[model samples]
Target: MDKKLIGAIMAFSLAGSLLFSGCSSKNQNTGEQTAEESMIQDVESEVTLGEYKGLPVTVEKLPDVTDDEVTDAVMAAVENASVTGEITDRAVASGDTVNVDYTGYMDGEEIPESSVEDYNILIGSGVFFNGAESSLIGVMPGETANISVTYPEGYPQEDLVGKNAVYQVTVNYIVSEEQAELTDEFVSQISDCQTVDEYRQMVREALETSRENEREQNRRNAVWDKVLENAQVVAYNSGEVQEIVDQYTSYDQSAARDFEMSLEDYVQTYQGVTMDEYTAAIEDIAKQEIKERLVIDAIAQAENINGDNATDEEIQKCSQQQGYDAVDAYKQDRGSDGMAEDVKGLRVVDFVVDSAQITEE
Candidate 1:
């Protein structure tokens, strides 16, 4: 099995719990087939769960989905459903989209990169230099003015850092974003609803669904953490640690390439750490991940929680029903044996969640 696949599955398994991310932010998995969905599918081989009872688990403050949240999401979606409209008389303002032609000069030399023709920009969008958008305030259409601003010292472009530049800017017209009305026509654009009320209901239900998912994930994490606390290991191996480290390094390098940055620079800029520090962080994460894998595997074996134990023909039918093109295709993409093992882990999680003594606060 691919080590990256194992890591990806681990991430998927714990994404909703937000245990591995170590950040206060939430992880929203939006994909055609989320990692959790793929792994939760039925297995073709027999599997088992281990002893997972009487674990003392505590979950605090279950998630709540409110009407205000739904309304906010709907309003934001409406704002994004834009229509082009001309600003007749008013000067440019924040949130207003406007077209302009501009040329910049620094130290008596024209900055070619700072020049744009018939460019459309959103004021206060931070797409331009600091103070550039604010300087455009009160500038009427078809008017020309010279605006000056200084680039910050730590600007990514070393040549432009701490330098003052003057721009000769002209406002063509504002292509203002006119929000769509809460009408049947507008609602149909974003959903299968025929009315505003139905659309709002759908939005509310979606928020509730998300909240429910979060609540369930929190409960499961609490149970798993309890099991870990009392877990006893007679023996273990560090053989998979190297594979995990290699996978982590490769993932970081790929992200650095996507950002068009060197690995060291990417670490410093995004992770706020040196390359060595980032490596040590990932190594620590790998250790924790491997430990969890071993514990889950041991539990799976002890409980005998076989998921499906279906024949090849049955597996093919199950795969097709789960939206796979074919059994062979699913196996090729997500190694059949690996997926089966993951399913067993999920079964153990289910059993633990069901049997644990939970307290909600």
Candidate 2:
């Protein structure tokens, strides 16, 4: 897959253990470990762990949330609760949001994909081709106009690149939008607060709690970074890396099928990369990910917190944290092996963080 897809899969896989399933343990039904599990076990045995315990790391002290931050957050909440209403009294202008019906034509031939009705567009927003939306400025509702546009170079559709096209556009109406005013009544409507003062306090407290969580995460990251720096992979497993690449390829094919598009077109449209470029990078991405997993597995094994030993409560909590309704649901989507790996990886990281010698900056 392309960089975007590769980054997404790698992030989700490495973030906790939502992707990839392999452990040294055997399946209850088969009584034999799968190829992936065997490969992971081999890689883990080959890894040379660094001095993870009491690793020295520095962390920044948490800062107090200021009143200005609280006010800004409250304003953001109010902005999110803004309203949009239709207006037909005035002519469309720059920066006005207009609903339009349009059809694009190139050399008297209609561009089928470019025809849309009741499409909401912001003037000068670049959502439409160059000057297409801007041309609607000064046009009153119910009026129709023809605007000429030249498709820019490097357009997604090769046939449309640098081609001159005419858009027949009809303005339906302008959308008038405004942010809600911060008042006692508005605060009560958007939140449980009875007044602005209560809302502000709530926002401040939320900000403080968010910052503390962020500080704790930073400390953990610092500790892990030091541990990884000290560790080394003595032998690289090509089989393990290829397994991950195959999994990524399968996911890419499934995604293409879901979008009802060819794999080449899907990669181009969603990932902004040619199929060849995407294929070239998959191996490297898989290698990096497999390396990280092997290190995590080795650490977990050394700490006696392997996936086979994860508790049911730990699994449930991990599933809930990852947005699953329950442990069974998580296992249904991402097998029991994947769930165990997630719990085991998290326990290892927490153990390393707890054992670190951290100094506040």
Candidate 3:
């Protein structure tokens, strides 16, 4: 409240105001933006509406976006898909987990006929195969399961028709994949690898090899698929599927043949009955196979899996795997008809592969 001081403060305030008014208005970083200038440029050109394709599309539903979220989602969905799973005849497991062996039989039947190991992952994943995986679940390795499953219709075992068997499963141990670590010591321990790069190279090569193997197996599967595809697959009725299983596995003949007797003779000897009476025992099995095939086929359609209809390149690769020429394999698998059926199956599975929305665990 000193008069001189107050006058001095007023003069200073006025001078500062004038200085600010005369100062340059441009931003320092770009050397072009005025304080009053808009941060936005002509942004009207970037927006798209309605026609976008992607999950969680549109900025309204998406997080962390002012706009253009739909386009980003579309691109993200398209970029990840790689699965080359095998369908094998066996699997190994035991303990808390099913230490499945490719070798499995009804509980007490002795030596395993299937030479493959750890071939199937179906049951463990909740899909039952002969009820093997399902019965195996909820049991420890040291535990035993009198696993009884009806032979799949068209099952090669005629005697096994609704015939229950016991398995004294001595689940030895459950195997698990030990997660890999990128450490120098680990590299040294696993190989004669001197450097980390060498170990990485080894891993890359192993992955490539696995991919190639899967590709080859997929190709072989394509052959079977092709046949089924063009076979005039009937509507979802299981009878049509049974027809297919009969053709492929020829299980009925196999069963009778195993006993070194005609089916007629075996039927009479086993039950003192005619083949007609025995046929009833195995009829459902054949039916089941047909039904199973139908279910698979249905899944193929629903999932759009078309591996049976493979490409020229895919065929060529598969042929090379069997050490036979691609054309020769096609001829052997699809005489007179070319590879039409084979192609249909391949295409369906390919579509499945193509359409799957995958995620990493």
Candidate 4:
């Protein structure tokens, strides 16, 4: 998960619902396999109404895929499905940390909650806010933040314009993220692919595909913005607050070259003069990610669109598929599977196809 990719996805997710992220935002799984089972049992009654018998069905609001907006997205992906980055900047190492500062404000207010200073953070640690740390990784210590943007219109504060909120950030630390010395464990990360290039390509495609899907979601959400203006979207946050804290640490590692430094060295390397400065920044980003995730989950549930399903069997397969002794380690955080999240994304895609009057751009 490249930070750029994650940042792009998060931004896309926030912008979408109708246009940026297709449905929901990024993912965070922790004890979800176990938690979903319990959640499922608590409300078994709801599903009794009847399964759609089609088993693994694809529902569409449109009559045909040929002339529908869905195809527009598919065709766009097919046309642009290729890797094209020059790696303009290469880091001395993936696990390097320097110094950094950020001026975060809510809307137009110089609110401290929105601002953090001299924040020191580990490169691969899930300490900074959404996409921020990841994006900052490859950058030089004196460089600006990789992912900077203004708060969106629909964001919490009415005062803040959803324009780009820029920051002067630095890469306080750098470590070699070069793939593990092609060891059994390292090879195992991409066991799903045949070769290293394949592995990288697969990862690249996964990222591109995610962005493409989010775009479709955004378009669909836009249609819904007009259609479901008054729809009672759920506004509750379920799931532990710390769940984010623990879950991202691992994901952050996955995004960068699995940071080479220990958490302590990683933290101290960042130029942020104070611990509060560094931590507060990460806290804000993480919270935004949470909000984006829940929003998508809620929207997905309202519509019947389904994305990837994490059934007990799928979990087991993922475990064996990756040659891991236990699949649980990979997805120890998510809950009840992302049923709500999948449904939201699916429905939004379907809605856009069903409603939007698309003309090729």
Candidate number with greatest TM-score = 2
**Superposed Cα deviation of residue 301, candidate 2 (Å):** 2.6
Evaluation by TM-score, superior candidate among 1 and 4: 1
Give lDDT tens digits, candidate 4, residues 1-361.
2233243433332221221233332223232332222331211112111111112223233322233344354335435443222222455233444345666543454544555555555666645544356676556544666356555556666766555555545443332233224333443443565454555455556556765655554554444444332222222232433444444444434433456755444444533223443344343334444444444444455554555554665455333322345545535422335333433444444544564464323
lDDT of each: 0.65, 0.72, 0.40, 0.42
- Where does candidate 4 stray beyond 4 Å? 1-239, 250-278, 300-344, 352-361
Stretches off by above 4 angstroms in model 2 are 1-7, 10-45, 60-62, 82-179, 256-280, 307-313, 320-328
* Per-residue lDDT value at 306 in model 3: 48
lDDT of 3 at 21: 9
Tell me the TM-score of model 3: 0.26
- Candidate 1, superposed: residue stretches over 4 Å from native: 1-51, 84-177, 233-236, 254-262, 307-331
Residue 361, candidate 1: C-alpha displacement in angstroms: 1.1
TM-score of each: 0.56, 0.56, 0.26, 0.27
Q: Report the Cα lDDT for residue 86, model 1.
A: 77
| Best model number under lDDT | 2
Mind sharing the TM-score for model 1?
0.56
- CA RMSD, predictions in order: 12.2, 11.6, 31.8, 23.1
lDDT of 1 by residue, 1-361 (tens): 3443334433442232212211111333342533222332222211223346877777887658878898898898887786667775888877777899999898888986878898987888876785477677788899987988788777778988888988889999988767677778888877899998999999999889888867776787777766654554333234455566677677667878999999889778866777766665554455445445666666766776654564565455334423466667656765656456545556666778888888888
Candidate 3 has an lDDT of: 0.40
Model 1, poorest ten-residue lDDT window?
Answer: 16-25
Pairwise TM-score winner, candidates 2 and 4: 2
